[model samples]
Target: MLFNEEIQRVFKSDSWKKVNKKLIGKMLSEYMYEKMIQPNILSEEGENIEYSLQVSESKHYHYIAQKRLFDSFDVKWTTIYIVENDGRKEADSAIELLVDLQDVIGMSSETAGHLIKEMNSTLIADAHLLEKEAKRSDELIHEDYASLEGYMTGHPWITYNKGRIGFGYDDYLAFAPEQQKEIQLSWIAVHKDLASFQSVEGLDYEALIASELSEEERIRFDVKVKQHGSEPSQYYYMPVHEWQWKNTLVQNFPEELAIGRIIPLGKGEDRYLPQQSIRTFVNITNKDKHHVKLPMSILNTLVYRGLPSERTVIAPKVTEFIKGMAEKDHFLKEECRVILPGENASMNVNHPYYTQLKEAPYQYLEMLGTIWRESIYTYLEEGEQAITLAALLYEDHHHKPYVESLIDQSGLSTEEWMEQFFKVVMEPLLHYLYQYGTVFSPHGQNTIVVLKDAKPHRLAIKDFVDDVNISDQDFPELQGLSSEFKAVLRTEAPEGLTQFIFTGLFICHLRYLSNLLKNNGLMEEETFWSLLADAILNYQSRFPQLEERFKLFDFFKPELTKLCLNRNRMVDYGYSDDDDRPHASEFGKVTNALAAFQLNRTVGSN
Candidate 1:
């Protein structure tokens, strides 16, 4: 009885072809009966069917109807008329009813609202499930990979706990434990010598007369007594050349000798290396009065040793060139050597390079020395060798055979090393950018990749000058650097020098990481991107500088997120849609909603 001639009109339209007309009509009837007739019929007592009719006439029903019928369609069509007729006209009218019904139901507000809500809920749940899966995957990765001790403040040496993959620094003496004992022994010996000597009791009258003897007379008497006290079998004193005695004094106690000392200057510090030494040229005036002058060579070495090998080479060369210019320009050496310490104390007595010069002269002889040591250690362990500039680039390590041997034995490929290097150094850096609004640029030769235990694992990021970005207020000393450094490190600039580093080191290296991981079957393409997105999101959540404007996860949105979500739904779940166009549209809507949520959250917090 509810089947009107208008329903026939709905069948003629193009919208009717998109869906089964019978199914649509059946669903519509079901919904109407459930809302209007069934509830009223099931009611007891004085409840009226008229009330159900009134409810059906309510504005909400019409609103839902409009939404379900019209908003649901990709292309919209309006309902024009509902006609009823008999005979041949009835069949024509039936087709017309189908056509009109097609437009109305195809763009249904109720259906659209139901589907949108259902899809959104599913996506949110999927995102949460994906997050859980990612966390589990991360745990698996950590389990497979070896862990090393991380650096800590206020420690002399870090403990590399092999089992737990934990690290900590304690109050470690700079020298080896045995070496420290040796130093203590030396100090005790000096104290014992000082203890044994006693002065003549009270200088009696006879003693005074003995003391009053002329300098030559005293020397002769002293010589005679020394001769009498000598052993009978052998003379105690041996003849020495006058030149030898004079030369000994001159060489050992020269007017300008390089003074160096190994001491623990800072007290109560843990993990302090005794290798750090203070060295300077001391001008000995009358043995007591001396002037301490710092040297450029020593300063350069100190700074160099503190950096990675790659950076050490570059920094020293630049520093040496600057020093040469300064010397030519008659610049005061003191000005060049000045260093600002934490306190207001100006330390002019010690050379700026004293730390390196006194502690590890051999270590700072050249940049190649450090690289050689690292490579040799890897080679002995039978790990993946490092491809140094020597073999691949056809250049020897400063033309040194020993250095070349170290590189050859290491057996690490440059590509592998670079891959590891980016992971260790560049990953943390991008994370820093997300959190702190800045990072150090580790471009050029400042980057180093090292292989360990047959797997490329270590990445050394160097060059703090062009790399580190601290707020101007926090690090006023940085103001002395060039304006380029300042601008690149600024928070406001997009695609600044800092971003260049991110794009170069992090984004570009992603492909390499993917290849390596995929080759080993460690991760698939979808998993790789998901992992990357998770890393970025985690970094942003932790750092969150200018979070409203900065969206690190956005980079992976349309590609990675869609792929993961759509793939999972299509492959695992049976979502059979003929066009497949709805999937993309669904993703777009979801992205829009997410963006809106982010914006709203930002606004609400403010």
Candidate 2:
């Protein structure tokens, strides 16, 4: 039997047919919404709508949509119909959709062709997820946090989220999150001259080794290096994603291999599971061991999955700087309970040639590295479970929402449950931006909300250093930051930093939860946004002393820039080069739905 039988079944079942249709619907709906293509609305009635986008003179596609906030649309896959440029009609196919849109989005034949392959890879993997029927959201809510993450469908906002461009069929079964396989990471002995290691002050490389590996395992590994005629002192031990080792590193580093500079020590016994972000693996065997973030050269979503040397070496400092600020503030420490996972250590091996290219694509320089991020389990209190905030919207086969079950289990009214959630997640995030000028990418994958007795008790945030950034106009709180760390930490205006929250947390994440809760009849949409407004206001009331900071990092602007993730993927990601990694693209504007509802006079003041 395949390791993840349920996922395997999805590929062999008819249930996935509908899911595929829905996916097609999603691609078309979101592409149009992002203004990648404009569609002509053919008809509309109460809850039914029809629209079509022209690909060429003789070809176009049409689908039904259920309109949503910010011009968002939930496409009815069953209704999708396509008319070929040849004047023939048929149902939608993933490849056909991309081919048709090539001219409309200004997609080069090369990019569109490559994108189609990625889309196919993503669709097949998604079919595996849909192969087996999922547990009901209510039932899944009762499962432990980590196990529950295995059920997520993918990013709710980014239209083509599952585009993991490099995996083949066998690789998908072995490494993709849907497979839920416990992979044995390959350990390597990189020559000290070619590698650099950094860690938090007390936790050195040796300590990390001892903690992750058994004494027997450690001795065997050390002895293996000696047998290979290399002392442990002369090399920096690092973990490589097994696939990358076989496919990229080994093939690309022939000179190092010939010189005995890059020694392969084989696999570590510590088993891990790929988290939602496939490149970052969770230590399932130990649970307490640090989560390892490694570079995978696969094109997943917007960027090539790799760790840059600059970001890797200085990750710990980013953690230390941010954690210290949060710990010092009594309100943040006590009432808010925001958890910042310390990125304690990192090891990065730079390519001899790529590192020299000052203008090379970032991916080439990022091809090999590992980051040790503290686990959410490490921060959990007894009886508390940590679940990705994205998991809240997960629907079972029966379409039951997880938050529905959580509210029931907590014995709180739906409104109260949502309020507590907002207080735990939003308040501390706002505080970080307003007081410290620190903004984190609190996207679904990076944010974990801790539940105690079924209520949101606290929040744990990860992806430190690379994903976390500070405003360019450093506030007084940033005086303690190291010049080395600050040099790499991205800086922007406080207004731009709001995108870290608005686009990352709100639009990409909470928007789905709010809509799900309302559609499921758990809570009204107004109640959802109102509770959020109250949380922001209440947090502000507690920090009257930081009034100027509030104005600088304003979250209540009437119109905020709506980041166009789909558009960016179709365009250039970060930079345009085979050697470069992609980054999120931003365009257009979205109305801050909460601006008109400043319904928090009881607590917050302007």
Candidate 3:
């Protein structure tokens, strides 16, 4: 084959073994929290516990892990060993462990089979990551925002984060974010009747087109439209991922192409880099250009990385609602100075057949759409640098955390750095939940940490089309929204709304940070979580009028519902194509560490 040399280079014996061993440790740590495999406690030594999992009559796996808050575990990758009929050996294969536990965990044969493929693909990506000589965390701290995304890994919570089912090995090499390849986006013009375009009140389609495309490029594309025997005035030009055009659009929308309803315009002048989410692209040539989110029908972390048709249509409206709040409220606008990067415009072209099909698989309906979001570069001040919250969880090849490097560079102790982090991230999120009865999924990927002099300064939250949610309870603030608007945005009950912050931020992102800090001897987990409680309490003190709302959306409860990303694929939902996208599976309850800190604070005050 074509990739003989490439394969030989990336899949060397030593590199492959190391990636698999690391993956197995992650699998064990996450599986324990999800209750997928209840391994018996073999012994205990302080926080570190030795555990044995009997996979079968003749086989068992043993490892050492440290139990942390939120009912989590940190498996020591070097300590894992597997014993079979022959003898005990160091565990080196994640697939072997998955196969051994398939029956033990009650996973169906079909699910197990698909999971094996996903796990193998994840291993391949991991091996590629391992083989490359990566920049140290300290060096990466000074990198630009767009370039920094190419360094960090994927979701901290999901084990099979890069299981991109739709991609071939060639596609993975060319398009994966870590590869950091920059390419021009291919453009397509759709007949006005077949496409719908929407934008915020001030911007229209003409203005957006003018700002995005040069006068010469517009003329060149207009000529292409005329060649297809369609008037340029009757079509809306939009950018499409080259992979989507080749893999999904040409195959799915043959009828549109045949009838001259969808015409291919050549690639644009600007070269763009794909962000962590494979579908979203950032313009590298012009930093202030809008970030483009296109549909790429790949099964990655939880859902197809495709924009939902309904959400695509209403994305700009959601932006107006979210930005409107920030503009009016003095706290959000002036005091907090939180950044809301709006989805300024969107275009959706429904599949001619799937749109009419009742309960069609969701991936087909979402194959072609684009959302234009305001660039983060446009909002940055002179001294501010923006990094995704996920970057904080990254550890370099030397096992030094990026957050520690940030703290050292900031001239602040770990506790001081952490206090500022909690305050900057929590105040805006809490205000949205308690005051406006709204919440953004402040998960690592969606939340941006704005730093000044290497210290957390303010917050910027993005990806509103998919993540912004509101309260199901009737609050006067939400009364102005139309039913259509409400329908597009997910409305959750009080606890459910709170879960967006409590679980999405605390459990999904912060718990891992706390674990890293504890492991690296930076800070105690208790002090880390206690500072978070202080941030929330401090916000409450500022807004006593929202006291009842605070009670309604209580984060200080003794326990909260546990959500599992791994279990969603491994057990409950599986690989079966459903009409709707899968969600995070709720299994049990997580002990609320913040609750304990809150109680301690109240008692000490007394």
- lDDT per residue for candidate 1 within 1-606, as digits (tens), equals 442432343323442332223222222332332221121222323311111111222211110111111001110111111122311111112223323432333434443443333333222222222222122221221221111101100111000001010101111111111112111101000111111111122423234224323355444534543444422122111111122123221232232122211111111111111111111111111111111111111111012122222222233222322223334432122321211101000011111342245433422322111100011122222343332111111111122222223323346543333333334443445543443344444432234334454343444333332234443333332335455334433333433434344434332234334433443444454444444444444445654553743544243222222111222222222222221112111121112122333444457669
Model 1: lowest-lDDT 10 consecutive positions: 152-161
Off by over 4 Å in 3: none
TM per candidate comes to: 0.24, 0.93, 0.99
Q: Is candidate 1 or candidate 2 better by lDDT?
A: 2
User: Model 2 off-target regions past 4 Å?
Assistant: 1-16, 56-60, 83-90, 572-575, 578-580, 599-606
What are the per-residue Cα lDDT tens digits for candidate 2 across 1-606?
545654555555465466567777878767766878778899999878888777778766877877766556667778888777556565546677777777788887777877877777777767777665567766777776666767887888766678777777678878888778889999888898999888887898889877877888777778878988889889877889988988789877988988889888888998898888888888888898988999998877777787877888888888788888888998789877788889998988889987677788776788788899887788888888889888887877776887888888899999889888998898878888888888889988888998999899998888986788898885787776677777889888877888888888877887778778877888766778878877887788888998888777776778777678778867755225655445566677777867756635534555
User: Which candidate comes out best when scored by TM-score?
Assistant: 3
Error of 2 at 263 (Å): 1.3
Greater-TM-score candidate between 1 and 2:
2
Quote the lDDT for 317 in model 1.
Answer: 29
- Tens digit of lDDT per residue, candidate 3, span 1-606? 788987998999988889888889999999999889889898998888999999999899999999988889999998999988969998999989999988887789998897887888888888888776789988989989988888777888788878888899999989999888998999999999999999999999999999899999999999999998879999999999988999999999899999999999989999999989989889999989999999999899978888899999999999999999999999999989999999999999888888888999999989999999999999999999999999999999999999999999999999999999999999999998998999999988899999999999999999999999999998999997998999989999999999999889998899999999999999999999999999999999999999999899999999999998889988899987889999989998988888999999999999
Relative to the true structure, candidate 3 reaches a TM of 0.99
Q: After superposition, how far is residue 256 of candidate 1 from its true place, in Å?
A: 30
Worst 10 residues of 3 by lDDT: 125-134
- Model 2 sits at a Cα RMSD from the real structure of 2.9
